[model samples]
Target: MLSNTIFNTIQKISFIKRTKFYNFCKEIIFPFIVTNISKLFKDDIDEKLIVMGAFGGGAFVDNSKYLFEFLNERSDYKLVWIAKLNHVAEVIRKKGYKVVSTYSLKAIKLLRSAKFIFMTHGHMDLLPIRFSPKTTKILTFHGTPIKRVDFNIKEAFMYNGWGDYFRLKLKNNQYIDYVLTHSGNKIEHDVLSKQLLISSKKILPLGYPRNDILLCKEKEFTEELKKKYNISEGIERIILYAPTFRSNLIVKFEISKQELNRLNKLLNELNSLFLIKGHMVSEKIDFNDQKSIKLLDKSADIQELLIISDLLITDYSSVQLDFLLTLKPVILFPYDYDEYYRTKGLNYDLEEIAGGPIVYTTEDLIDTIRNIDNIDYKFKEKRIMLRERFNKYVDDKSTERVLDFFNIKYRA
Candidate 1:
């Protein structure tokens, strides 16, 4: 237990001193307790399963979405989903799935008892519980990472996570057994291993289960979405511009109001609806007056949007890789490319491997969108090569592959 004297001393000290004291407690004292407690209750634990996402706050999106759909119906193992918010728990409960708050007594018992724990993000709340030797941990990464991530820091001021660059080196590798990888290449694997300090052998090349929905021919789902969005037949082309968040960004977009108007006009002329899907960190954007341009709600299913979209416009987002499965056209809008590269380093040169025209200016973006019909055909061969390099399986069997590898059978 932390002493009151430590708190008093922390209060008396400078900000730098306080930070050091907190780190000492967190990195040293806290882990020691968790490690012992985990071992003490190891024998009492059950052979159950637990799945979480985005620190147990959000819905079962990303890889967990596919896994949940498959596992929810099965009667194999004792399953429990840890959601941080009551609303999220309610959503899961409405579907007849067992759910609990992350801090609930049930969750605490389940965390200790679950033989296998699958998560999109690290379970920071449950600390020092080592993987492999105790519980089998599987990390179904939320998205394909195109940016410098994990403990890989390029700039000092840009990073806002725990510990200094040096201290965070191997910190992320703690209590994790298997890491799901998207790229099938050896070089990319090596890069990822170095970045995350994970072993190459532990990296599973099971293509993202999330992408399975992309391959599914959900005509009904598409039609329903079309009706909801007022997208009629013969003019059903949808252009989705989903951009990545720049941390602590002062300026959002490089385009002017007039440029957006021009973009909207072009979309209207082409019988397309331009949708803007902002990042979670992005501030509230309103294009209500612009009829052709619409900002998707925060909770909108991106997969559904992707399915209906004829073209995608993005800058340094791994969503581009998922879009590759559709073999659709992507327009690169790297307006702040240099600033982004300097602040947060990219894993790949977006301009080089983009497989489509890279537009820097707003005028260029309008031009690219105007000729999207021809542009889609231009990058077919390049997209094919990119897919082969990144995706191990282009088929919809990725979810099945993951299940089979873990010996998790589907519901009869």
Candidate 2:
């Protein structure tokens, strides 16, 4: 098995630059060996067994986390979480949930025998091996699409030539049995199907399980976060600054130390706590010793953060769409719009979908934060409009819908 560092380094190399032998081993040789070996096991899939993981098994978060929580409370199925890291496994085990190491023999057996396998990203959620054909593979993708994804992106590393593209399409279509989407709109469903290289019938517009918590436990989570973070007394608001990951560029604070200090002072005056939650793949920013600013743990669930936040600040992230559910003000900070657009193309025009003020400068961001109340009032209708376009169901029954769609029985 390749270490993550070497694997990531190899992935960063342009596909065309990689040797033919490397590409053959990766795209063809590997899958053939895994598939034939998996067939030899002949493990009968257990009808009630369900296995799930997210963020390459390094985090217990995203659609998988919420759905796992829902199923964990019931006594209908055998639930297992695949954890790549020992600490992650320990954390979930401490909570009395079943967790298996990604490389464990037990985990391999589970993957071979699970009736249903749920993942947020791809094979990385569990072991990157071909599973039994009887296993139902479901991808509860982490976010709604705003940026181009999978085959839709022209510069994606998976495609070196037409042959690589066709092979990937075949592999994806074979592995992914179903994909969950938030909106019921056919346009969105079709777009997702094409991007994922799967049949349109495979797309399930059953809403996102992650959004269920946003609707069901807003107050509970808000209070929990305030206490957990030791929020200062008299703090009136919580502002979440969540930026999307960039493939070709780093996400930086951009503002100088003096400007950041000034922004911190302004936040203090507003009695607000500003939380910075960068994407998992993004560069980390330090906010230690800043009274008003806090850099959230990278592993912290963004949905939980969204529920606790009074307002959101972001740039081209699907998080802004999720924040629309809160009906709170959102401020877009597209500081590198041109560069980002050039590298990672957007699926939609940023201006068309922006539900709030779009600020390109630190000064503008600060100004917008200072006048957030006015921004909130002015953007309420826009947020509602965008929400309708994106989310089909606003209720806390998405998890229920998913189970019903799959005909999985559970306790009421």
Candidate 3:
């Protein structure tokens, strides 16, 4: 099996090397042909509207939509449009904003005219995307950056999909105009502003602005989503298993199967709703569901679900920490934990970080749930220690605070 696995690895690299290298180079070379060196910051910071040269998948897409709308209503510095995918770009376009694709010729042209370039916890690394300092790049790091993301460089450089498309395995030393982060918690060890090292002017904390909606009750939205997906009623409890992908050592885009009978069997036994929101780069799993257990490809409204979910099952996912802010239960299912930790890595120990149960097998996870009521004393202790540090706001002004820091001046 080991020999066959080695041969398969070689075969996969050989196949990707055959055609994708040239295509990948095309994407890298696109920067030169994009907007000229001087054009990135040319339009005098068009306050009438801001232009974000965006990337990444859903998190970025979702947050940008809200930001775009907020900016349009209150200030002249709206993110007028984005060079992004349809889900977010389309909605903003519908709001009378332009939504263009990023990296392609069309994207490049959009950036040429763009006065402000921004990325929000998205996948599009600004290293290759950086054309000029005048462009004014704003990076709103979605989650706290984990300590170890790259597992094997040699193995990664040899592949296509697993490397650059997901993690920014490359190093970027460029200084951003502003880094709008979920502050209140120290990004570095500084925890607060005065002891900072990086440009103190740019390290503005805005609480987690996007989680505003997540903190609310979107029952209608949930019902609509459930109805649209034809999800059956009688779901007593909803649990989201969001696992963060480790780098090359952790195969993010792995092939998975629909455990139809297994899933149903478990659902019948446990009587709960389970959602497998695979990491952004993770491969798809299609298990057409009847009533019991349903595996989703991905859902755009994850924050909404996060609000409704009773418990969260995760593995090295920052979402677990995010969910903790809601004062809920979280469980771990680190199936490839050792391999993931050795290869890619974590900021801190998972056991140390989580305030909840660390369970692996399905039975173990179910058992944790069964005994969830009694676990609050331990979780609350961690929450009390970490809450003030991580969350600055006990209310709904995170987005407003962020926009204010950007000097965008949008209304609440």
Candidate 4:
């Protein structure tokens, strides 16, 4: 109880002030804990079971979604998920599965016992599972790279900040067994290898399992989602606007009333429904009063929404890569391009690879949407080239390839 209170108080202190304290913990406290962990807990590790954690259990819609479903169907293995919030655990429980709290003793035992541990993100919540000595760690990686990642910059990662104490010194990813990747793009694969500090041999070029759903023609699912979202009878098409999560920039771009009015008018003229999905970390803007636009929260399934969207609008987001699998039109809205480039450092040129018109403002966005039919055809070849370069195995057999690596026979 006292330790928790002290840690909470320390967290409230500014990051700069708390650096020395975390460094002390890393140098002195960590070794003592690691050496004595066996004395604190007594349980034989279970090799058959696989344990997984992601985004602190806010949503189960990433790589874990497919892996969980796969493991759940196989009665031979036990799958345990660790969530920070009880409500998040409850949602998983209702899915006919088991979930343990991040701070629970059960989670500790599972972490110590599990043979395989998979994490989608490398945040602090995953520390316990990630550091487990016996487990074979695999990261499905949350998204395709757009901005320069932590591991890519050695000075920023290892020397410049206190973040290195947590990300590198304590949870050293050197022990990672494998990291997933998509094939055909040598540049992307090389960048991922360098970013992870893992050998290229350990990086599997298996296509992302999450993208497999986009390749299917789920007419019934699409109809059901439309009904669930309350789309009007006359809506001809749906345009999905999903932006990538930015660490430094939290506030999303807001539209003025005039711009909103114009957007609504254009949607009416195009006979389209505009669905806006903000980054998971973003606060929802009040668009409830707007009749033509539907605001989707973090809980919404982005893949399902992408399936129904006729066009996609984004800025520096990897969702553009995922949407390309559908051979649909996309518009790049880099309103803060200079600011973003300075801070996050994009790997590729936005205009060069956008596969459609790269708009700098909301006015350009509206204009592009108004003339999308011609724009789609104009960028058709570019989109195909980008798709071939990034996605080598478009046949949707990525999940099977991953399972095959572990010698797990997939019956399907």
Q: Number of the top candidate by TM-score?
A: 2
Sorted by TM-score (best first), the order is: 2, 4, 1, 3
The CA lDDT of each predicted structure is 0.70, 0.79, 0.55, 0.72
Candidate 3 C-alpha lDDT tens digits along 11-128? 3464464466644543343333332442443444343446653344222344455566566677665454543344544555666865554434445444445556666642243224
In model 2, which range of ten residues has the least summed lDDT? 151-160
lDDT of 1 by residue, 106-146 (tens): 55566777776777655542334433355677878766567
Winner on lDDT (3 vs 4)? 4
Q: Which stretches of candidate 1 lie over 4 Å from their true place?
A: 1-43, 125-132, 150-170, 228-234, 249-251
Q: Which ten residues in a row have the lowest lDDT in candidate 1?
A: 151-160
Deviation in angstroms for 333 in model 2?
Answer: 1.0
lDDT of 4: 0.72
Per lDDT, the best of the predicted structures is 2
Per-model root-mean-square deviation over C-alphas? 5.7, 3.6, 7.8, 3.9
User: 1-412, model 4: which lDDT tens digit per residue?
Assistant: 3433454465456474337557556443543454345246654667678888777445676787778777787646788887765556778899998777665556667777778777776433344333455667778876668777753345323433443443433333555777887665778888777666667777778877777778878788778877877776578989998988877435476678889889988887888989888777566577666677877766677888888888999988888988889989999888888988887787777777787888888888988899989777889999999888778887777778877887665456
Count backbone clashes in candidate 3: 4
Sort the candidates on lDDT, descending order: 2, 4, 1, 3
Which clashing pairs does model 4 show?
Answer: none
